[model samples]
Target: MTLHCLPSTDITELPATVSNSTENPETQTTAPAEKSAWKTLSGLLPFMAPYRGRVILAGSALLVAAAATLTIPTAFRFLIDRGFSLPANVATDASASATAMADSGIAAGQVNSVFLGLFAVALILALATALRYYCVSWLGDRITADLRQAVYSQVLRQDPVFFETLRTGEVQSRLSSDTTLIQSLIGSSISLGLRNSLLFVGALGLMIWTSPHLASIIVGLLVLVVVPIMVFGRRVRKLSKDSQDKLADTGALANETLNAMSTVQSYVRENMESDRYSQATNAAFDSAIRRNRNRSYLTALAITLIFGIIVFVLWLGAQAVIDGRMSPGLLTQFMLYAALVAGSTGALAEVLGDVQRAAGATERLLELLHAQPAIASGKQSLVASSTADVAGLGARVDFNNVNFSYPSRPGEQALEELSFTIEPGQTVALVGPSGAGKTTVLQLLLRFYDPRSGSISLDNSAIDSLKLNELREAIGFVSQDSVVFSDDVYANLRYGKPDATDEEVRQAASDAQALDFIERLPDGFNTYLGEKGVRLSGGQRQRLSIARALLKNPPLLLLDEATSALDAESERKVQMALERAMSGRTTLVIAHRLATIVNADRILVMDEGRIIESGNHQELLAGNGLYAKLASMQFNAAEFHPAVEAVRVANSPC
Candidate 1:
C-alpha cells in the first residue's frame, strides 16, 4: 500500500469575487499607502508612550550635556584675555623689580587664574557628558526590548487570517531589523539630535550677542542648507521604503527556498533559486546605493556653503580686531561660537537623513500593527457549563443550510447549502470525490471560517457565541496532514492533552498501537522527532497522530482520512484502535477507502458540497446511489463479494 503525504495549504492567492458587497477594495491592493516622513515619525509616539519617563530622563540628561558643551567655547574667551594678561599692580611691580634687579637678572610672579577656571569648566562638562551617554544608551536597550515584546505578543494573539497576508521572514525582519532601527533612533539619534540642536541654538545666541553682523551671515547660510534638505527628505523616505521592501523580498525568498530544500533538490533547481535570490539582492543594493548617493551630495553641499559663509565672516572679524573695534580675545570667542554652530548644523543634516530612514521603518511596522484580522474574538467570554459534566462534552453539531466560499476564491463556492447532523455517540463517514467539500466540512467544523450565510451550532448554542478556545477544547481532530513539532516523542504525543501524566500518555499510545515501535527506539518516548518527524516512516507518524487524539480523549473526534497514510497491517491496527476509542464518543470520519468505514453507524456520501446519499454501508449499497458507485470503484469485489452476497441472501425473501 502506498501512502501519499498531505499537501500544505497555500494562502497567498487572491479571490476572484467578494462575498460581501461592502468589502473594502483597499484590502485587495498590493501597494502600501503613501505617507509623509513627519507622519511616519509621529506614529511611533504611541509605542513610546509607555516609556515616557525614560524618554524624559534621557532628554534631560542630553539637555545638561548640551549646556555644558556650549560653555566650553565661552571659557576660551576668558582664558585668552584675562588668563594671559597680567594685572596692572603686578605688571608695575614686575617692571620696577626688573629695573631694580636688571643687573642681578631676577624675576617676579605674574600668575593668571583663568586657566584654573577653564580647567574646572572642562572637568564638569566631561563628567556630565559621560553620565548622559550612559543614561541614554541604557534607555535605548530598555525601550527596544519593550517594543519587541509588544509586537511579538500582538502577533501571537492575532488570528491565523492575520498571518495569511504576512510572511514569516517579513515578520521576523520587522521584529529584528526594524526594531533595531527604532532603538538606534531612540537611544542615540534622539539624544544626539536634541543636544546638537541646543548647541546650534546656543552658539547662535552667543554669536548674535557678541557680533550681530556675523550672526546674520551664519543664519543666511543655514537657510540655504535647509532648503535642499527639505526638498530631498521626502524622496529619501520613499527610497528607504523601497530598499526595505527589496530586502524583505530577498529574505522571504531565501526562507522559502530553505524551508523547501527537499523539493528544490528533488527538482534540481538550486541554480534557478540562486539566480532569483540574487536578483532580489541586486535590487536592494541598487536602492541602498541611490539613497547613499543622495545623502553624500546633500552633506557636501551643506558643508561647502556653511564654511564659505564662516570664512567670509571671519575675515570681517579680523579687520575689526586690527582696527581695535573688537578685542583679540572677543574675536577669538566669536569665531569659536561660529565654528560650533557650523559643526552642529552639519551634524543636524546627517541626523535629518537618519530620521527619514527611521520614519520609513516605523511606517512599515505601524502598517502591520494596524491591519485587522479576518476573524475577531467575541465580546462575551464563553464558560463551560460544568468542568466535570460529560453531557457538556457531547456537542450536537448541525450544519444548517451552510454555504461557504473560500475567502481567497470567492466566485467559486467550496461548499453549497450543505446540511447534515452527527448524532452523539454515532460514527459517521463522509465519502466524497476531491474538491467535493470534504475538507471544507472539517474546516467549518473546526471554525477556521464562518459560513457565508448559515449557522453551525453545538448543543443548541451557536458556535459563534462560544469562546473559540472553549469550543475547540471539546473536539479533537486528526487530519491527513499532522504537524509534528521538533520535540521528543513523549512531548509530541502529549501535545493534544498537555496536562496528561506519563502513565496516561502511555495508555493512549498503547491504544493507538504506537507503544511497541516507540519502545524500540533508542530513547523510546524520549527520542526527539527531527523536524516534522522526518525521522519516522509514514505509518509511524500516523500512529503517533492517533496517539495524540487518544490522549486528548475529546467527546467529538474528527478523523480526516486518518488511515489514508497507513499500510495494510498498520491500517488494521489503527482501525481497531479507532473503533475501540469511538465506542462511547461522537466520531466524524472523512473516509478515502470504503472498507475502513464500512461498519460506520451512518455514512453520508457527498458530492460538490451537497449530501447526496445517507445510510449505513449495506443500506447505501442496496440503494445503488453515490455510495455504491464510490464503493464499487474503491473496494475489490472478489475479496468481499461472497460475504456480502451471503448476508444479502440471508436477509432476502425466498
Candidate 2:
C-alpha cells in the first residue's frame, strides 16, 4: 500500500540488498559503527507528533481495557463466594441440595446484584477493547500514509545520482513491506504490549497482596526466563532486518528484469532470472524462519516458566485454604489473577519480539529519511514571470574556460578548458565523433552537472545565481531517446507546457509534424501511449518530444541528435518541422549526421573534450581540419554542396 528503494546490509542467511547511490559525492551519508539499530526509529517521532491526540486517546482506551480485564477476577470471586456457593453436606441429590440452599437462608437479591456486576465488568471490557482497537488501527493507517508521503516526497526531491546507488524496486519494498510491518507494530503489537504490560503489573500486584510469599518466589524464578529472551533478542532483530533486505533483493531483481522484459526474452534468460529470484526468496524464507523460531522459543520459555511458577503457587494457596489460613474464595481469586499474570507475561514476550521486528523496519525507513540530497535548490531561487524574464532571457549562452569530470569517472576529464559562446538567434551546431564532449556541453548548460573550473553564464549573469527552474525555462531541449509516458497523446504533448490550451497543443503538434499521425488514431489526440510510448513508432515519439519542446517555445532550443533514430522519410518530415521551429530561435544542435548542420550559422568541431575547429561549412573546409575530415567522410568531394557553395561564395567575395 506504501512505497521507495533502500540500500542493504548482508545477514547470515539473507540475500543482501545491492545498489549504487546516486547522491552527489558531496552529500553521501555514512553510518557509524557504533550506531544502534533502535536509534533508526527516532525519526518516527516527528511523524507521530502531529497526531498526539489520537495516540493519547488510543493509549487511554488501552489502559481502560486492561483495568476492566483486571477487575473481572474480583467480580468472579464475589460471584463464586456469595452468589452460588454450594452447601457442604447436600451435593449427592438435586432435591437435597435445593433444600440445603433453602435451609442456608441465601439472599435472592444479592445473587442478582453479583451477576449484574460481573456482566457490567464484561461489557466494559468488550467496549474498551473495541475502542482501543479502533483508535490504534486508525493511527496505524494514518501514520503509514503520512510516512509514505513523506518518504516519497523526499525521494522525488533527490538528485538522480541518489538513485544511481539505489534501486527503485528496493525502495518500493521498503515503502510497501517495511511500512506494513510498522503498521502491524502500531496497530496490534504495541497496543497488545501496553495492555498486557498493564495486566501483568496489575495481576502481579494483586498476587503479592493475596500471597506475598508465593509472588516473591515466582518473581525471582522469572529472572531465569528473562535472561535467555534478552540474549536471543539481538539475534532476532538482526534476522528481521535481514529478512527485509532479502525480500528487497527479490523485488529489485524482478523490477530490473521485468522492465527490460524484451531484452531478457530475446536473450532467453527467463529461466536464469527465475532461478535467481527463487534463490533470493528461499534465502529470505530462511531468515524469516530463523526469526520466527527464535521468537517462538522466547514465547515458550516465558509462558512455561510463568505457568509452572503459578502452578506451584496454586498448590501453596490450596494448602493455605485447607489449613483455613485463607478462604476458598480468596484462594480462587489469587488463582485467577495468577493465570492473568501468566497469560499477560506470555504475551509480553511476543510483543517484545514484534518490537524487534518493527525496529528493523524502522531502521530501514529511517535510512532513507536521513539521506540528504547533494543538489538541493537554494532558498533564494529566482522567480521568472515568463520565459523571457528568466536569467538568460534570450539565450546568449557562454561557457568560459570550462573544465569538468564526471564524479563516476573522475580521472578522465569530460570537458577541458572549453570556451564558446552562442549569440542570440544563432543556430550553432556541435559536430564531432563520439566522446567529443558535445553532450557534456548541453549537460553543463542545463546544470545537470556543474563544471569544475569554469563559469557558465546565461545572458550576462552567472547561471549558479539563478534557480534551476529559471535557468531551464529559457531552453527547449529534445534528446535522442524521447520519453513518452503511459498517457493520452495530448497529455504527453502538454507535459512541458501544462497550461497550453487545446488550440496551442494542436499548433505545436502540427509544427512538429506529429498532428497527422495523431489525428489518424481511433481516439485521435486522446489515444493512449503505452509505457515508454510502445504504442507509437520511434519517429512518432521523437515528433511528440519535438511538439512538447515547440509548446514551450523557449528562446533557446537544444537538439541532441533528436532525429537520429527516425527513418529517412520520418527524418525528412521531422527535420522540416525542426527547421521551421529553429528559425529566429538560438539553437545549439548536437548532430552526428553531418548534413543536418551544413546550413548552420556556425559549426564547432570538437575532439578530446576541446574544440578543434570553429567556422561556417566552407570556412572549415578550407582549413582542412577535423571538421573537413568529418565532412569528407559524410560527403564526396565531387558532389558535396558545401564544397560547391564554398567555391561560389569564395569567388564572388570582394
- Distance (Å) between predicted and true CA of 570, model 2? 1.9
C-alpha RMSD between model 1 and the true structure: 10.0
TM-scores vs. true structure, each candidate: 0.85, 0.87
What TM-score does candidate 1 reach?
A: 0.85
Whole-model Cα lDDT of every candidate shown, in order: 0.74, 0.76
User: On residues 1-654, what C-alpha lDDT tens digit does candidate 2 reach at each position?
Assistant: 110011011112112232222223342335434345447556678988988998888888777777777787777777776656776766768787667667666666767777788788777777777777888888888898998888888877676667766778777777887788778877777777778788889988988887788789878877777788787777777776667666666777788888999999999998999999899778767876877788777777766777888898889889988998987887888888887787777766777777777777777677787777765443334343333334343467888999999876889998999999988778999988899899989988887778889898776667777777767877799999898999998899899799999999999999988899999998999999898999998888999999999999888899999988887677778878888888767899999877677789999999989998999977898898988787666655434454334544553457
> Cα lDDT for residue 494, model 2?
90
For model 2, what is the alpha-carbon lDDT of residue 560?
97
TM-score of 2: 0.87
Name the lDDT of candidate 1. 0.74
Question: For residues 483-542, could you state the per-residue lDDT of candidate 1 as single tens digits?
Answer: 688899999998989989999999999999999999998899999989989888888998
